[model samples]
Target chain A: MRITELFNDGQFVVTAEVGPPKGIDCSHVVKEAKEYLSGIHAVNVTDNQSSVMRMGSLPVCVAMKNAGLTPILQLTCRDRNRIALQSELLGAAMLGIDNILCLTGDHTRMGDHPGAKPVFDLDSVSLLHTVSQLEKGVDLAGNELVGEAPKFAKGAVVSPCSDSVDAQLAKMERKVMAGAEYFQTQAVFDSEKFISFMEKAKQFGKPVQLGVIIPKSAGMCKFMNNNVAGVHVPQHMIDALAADKERAKAGITSVEIAAQIIKECRPYCQGLHIMALGWEDKVPELIKLAGL
Target chain B: MLITELKSKEILDSLTQGKVFIINCHGCKEVSFPEKEAEEFEKALGDKVTGILTTDYVCNIDNLPLRLEKHAAAIEAADTVLVLSCGVGVQTVAEHLPGKRVCAACDTYALPGHQGVTPLEHECDQCGQCYLNITGGTCPITACSKSLVNGQCGGAKNGMCEVDPTMECGWERIMRKLKQVDRLDVLKCPIQLRQYNK
Candidate 1:
């Protein structure tokens, strides 16, 4: 079923993310999603996330669809030029993938292949615009498609807790103008900040899914706090994660923290997007604990 | 001023294999240049260096011809004309001296204000459409890593960019500037997407 239909029916959507493997064999990830992520609104398949080369998100999304799951294909403008991006969109549409999340992907320097050239021929906004254009039956070059135009429930990202909240809000407005139907935010740890952001974001009249990143450990929290932009792990939360030195119970602790965040943010947003970051197994427990 | 650093020694050694004439643009006034590094490289080249012509503003197309005319003898004697300047200077020299093999000895990097005549703390990408008016003097195209015109991405922490931890977040700077000038209302205006074609 289309995510748009779920939203239109006023369903409280829940989604999870899974990264494609570096190699061709995708059976492991597919099985993992089927086991842990079934009954969710959708699963997001990352596209060469963090600039690291991986199996294409399109194929993984197709695999998920074949496994009787709905997938939201993450499309980034980091590797492909405008032509390839458009072609990918067309192919995804033909393959029955109806959801796309447009993003201005991470710079190439951040990934495994730093030497690779980055092609940002179109950014998230322009790519979203291109989707609208394609839906209208014409390409960016004004060339007409041979047959039926493909329609999609276009999604976008916003950093609600960015240092510059006004700037983020401004960009969010642009994304809406560029035809973003829904928004999923960067990892949000502070419920107060998320509430404030929702106050402003609600005016756009689009469904927003708050991003929840499960804290694996205190070290991981510190890494994200120091290195990841727009993500802040409160001191108390870090301390809680660090309480268990052996980390034998890290999985349970991580789920508890994620569930707490989801419970706190549930009242403000339309849905929750759990990013387990390789700990997909804990998602089912996290959702149950969050009272979802 | 366009900041330039010497190319890797291995690459330079491979490119300057034969008799080479060096055309070093000392760069504009107040701009920093790796003169000592270039000189050390020349000294290392030793007998392979035919001659050196150190001039200013090789990017000036009109003045380039006269400068090349003066170094015509040195350029004629060498199999390659190695330019120790920015990419523009290398292209200018190559255009003026098409017969000789032209090579760049230094790689150029964008300095904040190098695009303008006088160096400032800001840069203009010359994207043809100026957004300074709306952004309160901040050029998101040049300042932001992703060139996001709408506003900040989610990667900034404590006023620093996630991409380059050392650099200040472009959106933070813009937001501060807007608050200082009482133009924060501009941010509340309707969404405006940057025309990438421009």
Candidate 2:
């Protein structure tokens, strides 16, 4: 079933992300998702996330689907031009995939191959618009498709913890106008700020899934504070993680913090999107601890 | 104004291997030319440098031909002509001196100001569709790293941009400006999808 159906049915949707391996063999990630993420509504397969080269999200998503897991295909405008992007959308539909999260991917300079040419022919908003157009059986050039048009439960991302709330809201409104049925925010750490952002975001009338990133270590929190855009790991959480010097107990501490954040944000959002960046083993515990 | 920085010494060295004529433009109003750096580079080049001709406003198409004519001897003697200026200056030199192998000795980046005129704290990308009327004087296309038209991308920290921490977030600046003018409601008017064709 499409994620939108879950949202419409008033079920508190739960999703997680799985980064495809850089090599062709994705059995490890696929097996990991099937084993650990069975309770979640769907899994998002990132497309060359952080601009690093990896196995395409499409094939990995197919792998996930073959494994009896629902996969949300994450599409970015950084690698492909309009033609390639449209073609990929059609291909995903042909393969029975229905969910897409459109993003204006991280700049190429931030990736492994800085010399690679970035093809951001369409930003996130335009790409969402393109998705809506394709659903109507027309291509970007106004040409009709030869076969049945592809349909998708379109989604987009927003950053609620940004310094500028109004600017983020304005963009969220645009995303809604461009046909984003749902939104998964950037990793949010501050509950009070998120509550306030949700208050304003409620006006958009779209289901917003709060993004929760599992903080693996205190050093990881600090790194995210400095490097990750729109992600601010509060000092208290850092101190909490830092207090657990014993590496054996770090996973327990991480899950506890993630659960606490989920509980705090549960009242405001319609769903939860956990990004356990390589720490997928702890997700089952996180879900249980959060009482999901 | 166009902010320019000198290319790395290694790149300059590779490009300036042959006898080269240098044409440096000091015409921009407020843009700082890397004169000291260029001087050091020329000194390092020593015998490889055929000649140096410093001119003003090399981007001026009408005056460029006369300026190149005056330096014809030095330019003819050199195998390569190195133009130290913004892209416009280098292109002008290349167009005028098509026979010579012309190369740019600097990389140019945009500043928050009009090109070839008085430098201000704001810039216009000339994206044709002006958003200033709604943005309250701050240009999101020029100010934001991703050039997001609707608003902030949620990557800002303490008003600094996610792409470049040194720079202020464009949407933050726009919001502050809008608030100061009591026009924050303008951001809620409608969805704005940038027309790339425009």
Candidate 3:
């Protein structure tokens, strides 16, 4: 099923992101995608996330589909402008891709291939507007499409923990205004703050997908605290993980803590996007334990 | 994966400066199934796994000093290193850094990254065998193109694969790519899969 169907067809559905390979290798990406086998509702195939040079996202999603998995193709504005973006959207629709997550991609300078050029003609908002037109049976150029336009359940992302939450919310407002059906968040660490933010977002009239990350270790938590953007890992959680000398000793407890957080926040958000990063295997157990 | 999360500070302690170390895969790095399957292994050994940093160029002999300078502290302190580079790099790191537990983070599929939706599938194993001279350069393990091991089953369709739309179906992609690159007649004989066991 398409990711859009799950959003409307169920009370809450679980999804996760999978980064594409740097070459002609599906085994690793497919293997990483297996984390969704037991319970994850869908998977989001990242399109060259972090501006890193990797395989394209559309074919990767098709690979997942061939494996009988529902994949949400992540489309970034950093790579294509109105023409390419619209054409790709048409191709994806024809190819049976179900869900889409649009964003302004990372700056080209940030990737491993620093010398590569970037195409950021239209930002995420403009892309959404263009996609909305595709759904309306009209090409982006104001010309009528001969064939029927596809029914894509559009989704966008917001870093709720942005330094300026107000500004982030303002951008989110524009996306919604552009007809974004749902919204996912960047990795969220502090649940209390998310709850507070949700109190304000409830009026938006769309389902919110909360992003959950499984820190590989306590130091990983510290790393995210120190470096990752729009994410805030509570100190108490860090202290709890750090208290254990061995990570294995604290494994169950940490996942339990994560599951518990999901439970607490379950009522506030529509679903969770578990980003285990390199730890995709445990997502099934985590979701199962949470009864999500 | 920016260090975005850790910076979300509350009232008490303010987050200061932070950094993330990334390995440049140069042109040799590729991610495969082993890396995907290895996640379960990491989960089984939870909290023990740090992020696997893959580099195509930096983890080599030429750049060893720079790599050591950047991660010597982390390497010395940790029990295992999750390498996201190719299998050769992982094995090389293992050999260079004895007494340290190092494992492969990516599956080491192939050297190409610019094509297909599922472009991360296992294509080339780098066994030092060139079968493209016979059956075209498409990999059966990675593309699973037509599932026709020795030759085309006539099931492939117009450039795009039949089984998986994401992949080029090694054979089909190879036929087209070779034709494009002016090497269409490379298939002088039938491909024998057994000689390239690895």
TM per candidate: 0.74, 0.74, 0.58
- Chain A only TM-scores, each candidate in turn: 0.98, 0.98, 0.94
Give per-residue CA lDDT, model 1, range A12-65, as digits (tens).
889999999999899999999999999688999999999999999999999999
Q: Identify the runs in model 1 with alpha carbons over 4 angstroms from their true place.
A: A246-250, B1-117, B184-198
Q: Please estimate how well model 3 matches the true structure, expressed as its whole-model Cα lDDT.
A: 0.61
Give the alpha carbon lDDT tens digit for every residue of A108-181 in model 2: 87789988887667788888989999999999889999888889999999998876677788778888988999
Fnat for the candidates in order: 0.62, 0.55, 0.00
Q: Is the docking of candidate 1 incorrect, acceptable, medium or high quality?
A: acceptable
Give me the overall lDDT of model 2.
0.82
Better of 1 and 3 by DockQ: 1
Flag regions of model 3 displaced more than 4 Å.
A35-38, A248-250, B1-198
Separate DockQ for every predicted complex = 0.32, 0.31, 0.01
Evaluated on CA atoms against the true complex, candidate 1 attains a DockQ of 0.32
Q: What is the C-alpha lDDT profile of model 2 across B1-198, one tens digit per residue?
A: 556678777768867878999998896775668889988988888888878889787777778788878878888989778878765566556556645566677766555666675223445454544455455555677787777776666567777876678999877866766676466776665555565564
